[model samples]
Target chain A: MKFSDFFRKKSSGDVAKDRLKMVLVADRSACSPEIMERIKNDIIDVLSKYVEIDREGLDIKITQMDGEGEGSDGRTVPALYANIPIRNILERN
Target chain B: MGEVIVITSGKGGVGKTTTTANIGTGLAKLGKKVVLVDTDIGLRNLDVVLGLENRIVYNLVDVIEGNCKTKQALIKDKRYDTLYLLPAAQTRDKTSVNPDQMKQLADELREDFDYIIMDCPAGIEQGFKNAIAGADRALVVTTPEVSAVRDADRIIGLLEANEMKDTKLIVNRLRQDMVKRGDMMSAEDVVEILAVGLIGVVPDDENIVVATNNGEPLAGDASLAGQAYMNICRRVCGEDVPFLDLDVKKGFFARLFGK
Candidate 1:
């Protein structure tokens, strides 16, 4: 977190390997970190038009769906699922 | 039947062709009939690396198109009697052969050879697909660099997706001094990240450049890279060879304690 930490004598191989692990995780989830952030913002914007939702408590994640009865090929399908907790429903009274 | 093994890396310049050439030659040196196949097509370099570029009268395309028999297309190695090369078509592109054709060719070659080492092209394209189509196992070659390791991971994922469950990792171009100085990833570090079985770790040696330039792989010599490749060939043949100790300058205490 310090300035010197950014310029530490860490090998380029370690840095790149860590970055690659992050990238592969994002790729396997079928989304990028930046894209995930955008999706969260866009969803909050859309939901703000209808109700008073707890935006801070909203969570969005992409996970692999277990293909139990999908012909037994043992391949999991990626699915995007989100949970947006609502505190109150706003009325135009 | 001959075991078809593809030497591939999703990234270029990671020594896929070199590894294929060396491993093929090493297997032949062990008296196993081995044929090295270059699947790079237009950018074929395996023959040049093996020093058989001048003897390439027929290529993979020629055999696939029924223009030449498989035996006729195979160029015998000058050093190893059992070693051969199926050079890729320089003028033709990757579209000249498909996965089915490659599989058929591999099946035909399986009857006579003990091992078929396919030098796969870089990138996860049609050529990579075709190279692994007929292979029962894959040796994913990478360097001690991050880009190479990342690409190897992607290639492994692709191979597993295609039902090629038997995959091993070969960490090439490893610099022991750099690893000792904590400036480069060690072979264990790479294997941990890739999460694959380690087949061999070839030290960075200048002799490889000279040998490749001379159209002769170093596997027949006593170079560091050659020994590593020879061990890889033995492992491929189901021999449990211990890894070479790259840290020759280890402290006396370290060796005494088996560190």
Candidate 2:
């Protein structure tokens, strides 16, 4: 991060772009925030059987990434990203 | 057979009617036989916009319901010899017609006209479906606002799902000054977000209001928006035309000052 970044004000276009990016990701995936929350809870329940994890710190979001394959034309495709903070593995004897 | 094109936007007040009027007249001016269809049904305004409201004896519903022949509803334009309008029924709503009826009407019109332009109503409802049913391609109109662009995106997705893969974009009411000041999204920004081929970019001009009020199209007129619409018409006909330089005045000023 640059020192000037903290002080520089963002343009309205920048704000619109950021908001549009997030909204479009959700729209394209047909997944709302509520749906994402349900999926997150399900993931936490399943992961509890194998390991101990920090539920509060875990994050899951739908975002966009560069598309691949035929006819992509450098367009972006929706992707699901998840970050799980693990504390320890459960020992199965 | 003629080409049917639908001028549509998911949101209202985004110039779909005006674009239809201008492009249909522009195509006629280029010597093609063109017919403009107002498919908005209840909230029909394309007739008023095209200055043919008084001549709407029979409307789309009249023809679809077999009350009148298709030729009876077609009102010839006052100025353009080759341009005609199939006005929508003011008394009827969108529910009076369906996609099958529209497709049949388009097929019937295809035998007579070289180009058929359908002015679609706002929203992704029955009206929109009816408008696009007979269209060979779509020209999705949108403003620079976030809401308009978002709706355009949704409309594009719907179009793709319906197997209408050939779609283009028209970014309307683009204010160059606001874009320069970073207050509004530019045409490039809109195109990038929509991910569609840009057919044209119409500048925010008061001449549009004057033209619409006078019940005339702005195509081929002495205004920036007119020229932009004309260019779009040519592009629709598969002709290669350069986009107008909206920065021309600023460039001229800079050249005069040698800056």
Candidate 3:
């Protein structure tokens, strides 16, 4: 949204790791970045209808489950786990 | 038993065959008996890359189907006595040889060779399964590109799932000038994204094209890419070889100023 965000000098090191992790998580769950963003916006819209919430503080991420193990079929089944955090919910007057 | 290492890249044109050929030759040059196996089956290229295509009397399917002995099917390399190749069958598809047969073949070869390097076909299909089935370790080759890195990540997951824990990363076709200009991903960036141990980083060298066209892998050549492959061989041999400094501009100013 900000011009600084557009011109931000991407760190050559960590940027790659972050992108890789994000892509890997999205790939395993069969979700794309655009889909994930849309889902986040939809969730926020639905939540705002029921209760007041801090949209800026909200977070959503897809991650791989801990522990390396294969499925019963002996195929490595990467567990796609999602986490959503809402800072606070306000009561409707 | 010799180590069976599969050179794989989930995406095509990522230099799996080139890496296999060079590493296989590099190991043999180090006095280890190494056999390069072309497991692509229908679309084979290891023989051509190693310049042993014309010498192929029998293919891998011939040896697996008991039509001929494995040794009888292996084509000896003219450059090294310890180096050999088991060319893939061009007529048949990936379904012709299953993972079990591939495992059995690798097991038998383990008794005779110090390193059995399998040149895996691209994609996460039957060909991939067959190649990794017998591998004690995996060396995933990927370029420093978004698509290639993404595929490499998927491959790492698949390898982990298959219980192939000893996987290493080889970032190939890297352009040092691009990395310096922040136009391309660096080797460090790829390794960070893939979350694997770094084996070697091969710079994009024109000599690679020249060598491939000549049906000879630039393993021990004086070229930068060839030196990278040689370093990979050393690492595979359990030697702690330092990574090549691919930064092009680091010494340019000093050279110009004579500092």
Among these predictions, the greatest DockQ belongs to 2
lDDT of the candidates, in the order given: 0.88, 0.91, 0.87
Compute each candidate's TM-score over C-alphas. 0.82, 0.90, 0.79
Best by TM-score: 2
Worst 10 residues of 2 chain A by lDDT: A1-10
Interface RMSD of 3: 3.0
Displacement of the residue B69 alpha carbon in candidate 1, Å: 1.2
Per-residue accuracy of model 2 over B91-154 as CA lDDT, tens digit each: 8899999999899999999999999999999999999999999999999999988889999999
Clashing pairs in 1: B51-B215
lDDT of 3 by residue, B1-259 (tens): 8999999999999999999999998998899999999999999999999988889889999998999999999999978999999999999999999999999999999999999999999999999999999999999999988888999888998999999969999999999877865668788777755668999999999999999999888898888998999999999999999998875544767879852
Best candidate, lDDT: 2
Lowest summed lDDT across 10 adjacent residues in model 1 chain B is found at: B246-255
Sorted by DockQ (best first), the order is 2, 1, 3
Error of 3 at B250 (Å): 10
TM-score of chain B, candidate 1?
Answer: 0.95
Residue pairs with clashing backbones, model 2:
none
lDDT of 3 by residue, A26-83 (tens): 7778767788788888887888777666666666766654445554333223463434
Q: What is the DockQ of each candidate?
A: 0.39, 0.62, 0.30
Restricting to chain A, the TM-score for each candidate equals: 0.57, 0.68, 0.45
Predictions ranked by lDDT, top down?
A: 2, 1, 3
